[model samples]
Target chain A: MIATDPTPADRSLLATLDRVLRGNFTRREALATGRIDLPVGRLIGLCLLLGAIYGICLGSYSAFNGTGHAWLQTLASALKVPLLFVLTLLVSFPSLYVFAALQRLPLDFRNTLKLMLLAVLVDLTVIASLGPVFAFFAASSTSYAFLLLLNVAIFALGGVLGLAVLRRATRDVFTPVPPGKALEPAAPVEPGATPPVLPPALSLPAPSSRTAHQAADQARRLLAAWCVVYGVVGAQMGWLLRPFLGNPGAPFEWFRAREDNFLVAVLRTIGNLFGR
Target chain B: MNFATDENLLRGGADVTPSARACLGVGAAGCALAGLGLGAAAGDVRTALFAAIKVPLLIAFVAGLCLPSFFVVNTVLGLRDDFRAACRGLLAAQATLGIALGAQAPMLVFLGASVLDPYLLTLCDAVQFGAATWAAQRVLARHYAPLLARDARHRHALRGWLVLFAFTGVQVAWVLRPFRGTEGFPVQFLRPEAFEQNAYVVLLDHCLRLLR
Candidate 1:
């Protein structure tokens, strides 16, 4: 039979995973920790100064690329940029809130940024590889199947990475403390002296059996609130924008002009109802 | 508390903590460099650099928000705050990256085309294939480093690397295969009709209307 106690290796792995999930420290915090000899804060300040210079270089490059009509290009880019940001932000918000709400762990902003960078890296990687393969096939007079495959591949990879990262975060964040081991001091103390008393605000209450049930109830209530808010807001917005987004062309023409099949007619009817 | 007491308290207290801060800074800088490298290789310096800067900012913001939530949840559950912090950090990092990409799609497209030259485009393609392999290896290494480090499991990492290589090879083959004697995969996928009706076209039309 397997031993009841966790192996040392398992413990170490768990600890490492914990560290990866929780932050190591912020630069300012590290300065206080005095763990390292170097003045990290000063270094970070210097880096920020350099970053400002880098931004100017990038802006100059943008101007060189004929995107100098700043007002127009900026306006155009800004419109689409926010739409994409909101879409992603909306999709990922639930996971973020759930991790924070359910787990109560400190989020590492730096690592979050790294993950974003990683996703972009992955996207670029896929695009890079796919470009050549497409070229080779095109040169060889191949079928267009590769295009569909490539798109599917890219989407699948992005989805997997997003899900993995989120799932890992959720699991790490919500990992339950084993019963009977929940109320220990955060730091070890010497035997002869009084234990280091955590500030009452920071000291966690002992885990009660009912707490899990209470958290579940809270989660349900929060989700319900979200649903109601989205439903009402969505309907109101759609109502307001209806005129601008209203169908301009004849609904019948869309189906009848293209094909006269029964399925097309049925689809056209449904489309018209929604479109109106 | 008095000013002296407050200063002492602040000094003693770990708001950000040392280890966490170091990890964040190093991770951010590494990501920035990786982004820049990828951008340069792809010939879209602007998109890459923007990604680099934006990612770190998003990480910092998300991490700050999630830390309190993590503290609350862990406190309730009687879990250690350290564990909670770790989980929050990882999630924040992942989410920040994803959001940054979504925010920068237009810049990516515009600069992607502008940056690529005949020679660089070829290099970009090769690098892309290699990147898939690189990513797979990194994931495996990260998830199973301890196990892989042992004598018995050392070969497993190599096996993982091989799997990625095999996957890339198949992709390369699929890309190079022949079907009809005409256009390539990208051209075929980018239908002319669809291109004509795209947002860019609409924007151009709007501009023309304004000019008129």
Candidate 2:
């Protein structure tokens, strides 16, 4: 079981989530000290809440357009969106944890879990914040293809931001810098002389050892592999829980016939939207 | 309150808490004055009264609907502590919009008096509203600059709020229709089919018709 810290008044789950997004929790000091005190349980609750908010927006498309009992589609979507992310994480997280252990990275299983949850929460929060926009468009547009395309675009944006934060957090937490190893100070410029321009290639620090360089490469490869796995699993999970926006012509169903994959469906939708 | 000494509104300073009432009063007064000029296009007193009521309503109603979501976003992004400052800035921005509208009211009035074509009057009203919105955005940017300097996330938050505000504003304006009364149609607060029609759907239909 992961150790629990005393919940302080100031460090509410919302505030902690905020700090995570702002890159505060990923600072060298916080990572080095192993002081990430995220409330996992409360955060899960927050994720669910955020997901439900966005789901309602997603469902609004159906509510406005779908035939038969459309409100149920909204309710079903609210329940399914959070489930989609959680299910995807469950499917993909074990390999990530095992990879971290193999690499002897700083992240233990618990921290890995926390980081994953934080990333998912970030994704959900962003999607929820854009709920109003989605609802507005959903209400305004009658075309099912247009709404589907718009949703894909919104989810893509959320996924990109979430992955970026995850990458940054993982890098900061896993790579421990030795004490007293700091960036070289800039040389003072002579009075009235132009400053030297450092080449972009020369700006980055050289790896101190061959093993460190290998480890860094391995970590980057692992992160890339894991991101692909997560994204694929997430897309498939969303596909499995189909009918997010109930088709205007058809009656509402929780899941549609799972014939095509996400990418194929998206391509078809784009083709249909543009009359190609 | 003395308008010039209202540092929060005038200078975009967050040190002092700007009065909410002052912001609302100024914004409503200015927009209402502009509405009076707009309604004069039809030379009808009742239409003028209706326009005065609706112009402020359009501004306030849109703001009201968009603010709750913005607050939630700000809280999650850890800007809750600065919520009051942000709100003050927003209100000041609204006040700026009102002032801009009020400033352009005389021009609208002049156009109303000189122009006989209903299309020209409608075009003039649209131009003034667009100009006022542009002016309001300048004030909003000025007020939000300090917050943006403090945290870059404010930039996204402010941008999101503006987009939501504009989206909802367009819909609300559509629903509260007939700002420039038709020459023959009886003057009423709203068109008979206001609620039934949506701005985006109508625009889309028009586009499709054009293509055909």
Candidate 3:
């Protein structure tokens, strides 16, 4: 399915990324095309670049403050930043595609993957852009608690914005395509009672149609539920892949033993910051 | 362009974008001058020289730290087209800050020389900095007026930038400390434990102390 296109000949990878960053891809007209037309491989590559940028910034705190193996800690962080998001997406994507299909939404497996990657691209872009701010604070401030909280806040902001982009795109997806512009099915039909197995000649019903309305409502509900699930998965993924911001007091290690969860660590950090 | 004669800096114009290089140069020079006045309070030329370098460095660091986040925000809001203008506005504001401070330098130096109590001298210097900051903010608003007219989203972005810049400026300034040299201590570019402390934590500690 992925190899059908020869190459995205017109747009360079950087140009494609620039368009996405400027939100040209998420516009209603663009979304109304009924499939994310982004080059998935390039999107993944861009996501990695953005993630690594932020990761290096994250690691610089350790590099400047740690006792030893500063460069190794930085290298580890650069690798892990992309891994955190990509791993979480890989882990959560199968269920996302299945649930989206079962809900009879417009997305196929490939389209679903594209949308997920697009959402992640948005998240990582925002985080990476704030990399300088993070590095600056890391250099200037000694309070580990403050840096931890700042990182959490940044991630939260990125996540919220990314989810909003996803919501907007998904809303457009639920709308029936304009007359005669019926979206080409990206995948073979699932055999058993799937709406995707459309009667080939029949044009999609108008916006007022009941099935379309029901599908939109279903998509909304699914999106809300999926957001919670994605957040949980992402947080846990980050927790499991610990030591992204290497603790200055500790020697460099690739991963910390999984002891406490993300929530507990955040609360404890807040407490420590406030002299509790 | 010529900031001194540019009416756009006083009354915002969309077309008249200030020269970023010129703004930066003027701002740094003005800030360096202000630093000399500030360090003169220590009654030593050596301290004055240190302050001269650190003041501009502090401003540059704060702005540099905040720029990426600001650029991304503007881009996301579909205001990337006006980014050059927005940046020019921001730079003009920084230059205004420097110009305002520079204008106050002679008075600050006079105040430093005249004041008997070191605490009073510090208080007066703080008040001057606050006043200059207020002036700079006014210039920023003038610069931002055109942008706000173009898109209401610019308002949010402007507010966000201000909060971010101020928060970062405080921390950067704290880390690049001893702008005002302490009595009986050797003059140094930074306090020996400069990076060992965090400004927000110190503020929290002070607030807790007050509560106690």
Candidate 4:
């Protein structure tokens, strides 16, 4: 922990969140500038707090709440969504870090971890924001599959937004960019034209403009890798931690085989819905 | 257990009492008993009793798979004293999980009495467990934050260690299946069924099955 807390003028959580949500890198850039060093502890704390809040809001919904234990489960539901999100990130971060390093984009694990958490924070916020709507549908809907699909859609949408936030934040921390400027791809170089050389006095992205593109590509690849790992781990984790949504058709038991994973079974059933 | 923890533990020194250990044991056990166990809410007393008996074994089963790799990770990362700390932290997380799950026992009982359909009961069971386990993970992360703090040189390795946790945890969990009672299965201490293939293959099959 820092001896002195960041002064209010330096930055606020809300301001940074707004920046992150909008895919603006100013706040993170500020972090890079050393104007404010948000403690990793604080960042993680905020992430967990957001996770808890998000879980509580979204946990209240049920495709069917007629069961005797539904209310109790709903009470604990607040913890469920955040659990899945944070757990997925934890499960996936290591591989992504490996891939980023392989790309030679030498990422600080702490900063990368911070960005990963922030992305999930964005995700949970979106999910929480949609909680009320989903809750309404869950309350009214009788079709478990339809409600499940609706939630899957919302989660995916939120994930896309969150990954975008992470992507923007990653660029800011992994590669230093000049203050007060956007990371626009450098003007297409004219073949055989002498490159415009600015004096070394000003801080700028030192690497060739091509490296910027490479970093962007690198970040994209890293995200995809993380996403795939997260997807598989998350789905299996969900399966292992089974009975999340409660199977209306079967008696309440714990985990089943890996073969019964929600992802595959749902996808298969959905595919069959069309094929048949 | 105490010696293993104190003499050469993973992350930090172990800090647990016999009573504390018993408490975690009883808590997880009680959950599996009384028709209020984790994974699946027991539909009947017979099932609950069967699960209750295996709660301790279940913990060991998971740890057996995870700890060896975890130790290797700590050594490779050169987190010497942190090894005990890590082990302590993991056990503490498990205890925290047991406590959280125990906290919801009343509600689970309420649901058992009230809900008629198995699906709602099962989902609630899974969701509550998720809440409890996530809470445990938060504690574990806090413990590692410091150990992994000085891990700047090997951020990739540190991440790999964390990945090790997830990989082992999920696979171990997969093998220790029937956390919820599977459909049409009798209440048994362990499922007694063996995997037709390894978990990876099975998982891959699941993926491939989706394409079909």
Best by TM-score: 3
| lDDT on C-alpha atoms for all candidate structures | 0.34, 0.74, 0.78, 0.54
Q: List DockQ for all candidates.
A: 0.02, 0.12, 0.56, 0.01
Tell me candidate 4's interface RMSD. Answer: 18.7
Q: Indicate the TM-score of model 2.
A: 0.76
Tens-digit lDDT track for model 3 on A1-276? 211242464267766766776776665444554456676898899899999999999989886675488788889989999999999999998878777776655656776798888889988988998888888788777778889899999899788768877877777666655544433443564587343222221233455564656756866887977787788899999999988888877777899897989999888899898873
CAPRI rating of model 2: incorrect
| Tens digit per residue, CA lDDT, model 2, A1-276 | 012233474367666656666655555445543435566787688788889989999988877664577789899889998889888889988987787666555655776787788778878877887777678667655667767877887788678767767766666655555443432223455598654321122112333442445655766876787788898999988988987888878877888886889889888887775452
Which ten residues in a row are the worst by lDDT in model 4 chain A? A195-204
Q: What is the C-alpha lDDT profile of model 3 across B1-212, one tens digit per residue?
A: 24562345445543554567777777888899899988887788989999999988988888888888788778776788988878888888888788788778899889877887987887898899899889778888877887888799899778878998888888888888888778889989898888777888888988988998
Ranking by lDDT: 3, 2, 4, 1
By summed lDDT, the worst window of 10 consecutive residues in model 3 chain B runs over B5-14
Per-residue CA lDDT of model 4 for A1-276, tens digit only, reads: 111343574367665554344433324434344222345665555566665654444444432455555655555555565666667777778887777566544345665566666677667656655554455444443445555665676677567656666666556444554434432323555687654432221233454453556667766777677778877887776566544455556543333455666768779756643443
Which lDDT tens digits does candidate 2 get at residues B139-163?
A: 7777778888899989877887888
**Against the true structure, candidate 1 has what lDDT?**
0.34
Candidate 4 positional error at A87, Å: 2.0
The C-alpha stretches of model 4 lying farther than 4 A from their native spots are A1-5, A8-28, A31-36, A62-64, A172-175, A178-211, A249-258, A269-276, B1-212
Runs with alpha carbons beyond 4 Å of true place in candidate 3: A1-10, A102-104, A175-177, A180-205, A209-222, B1-3, B6-8, B11-17, B114-123
Error of 3 at B80 (Å): 1.2
- Which regions of candidate 2 deviate over 4 angstroms? A1-5, A8-27, A33-36, A61-67, A95-105, A136-146, A175-227, A270-276, B1-18, B43-50, B68-84, B109-123, B148-156, B183-212
What would the per-residue lDDT of candidate 1 be over residues A10-42, giving only the tens digit for each residue? 345323223222322212222121122222333
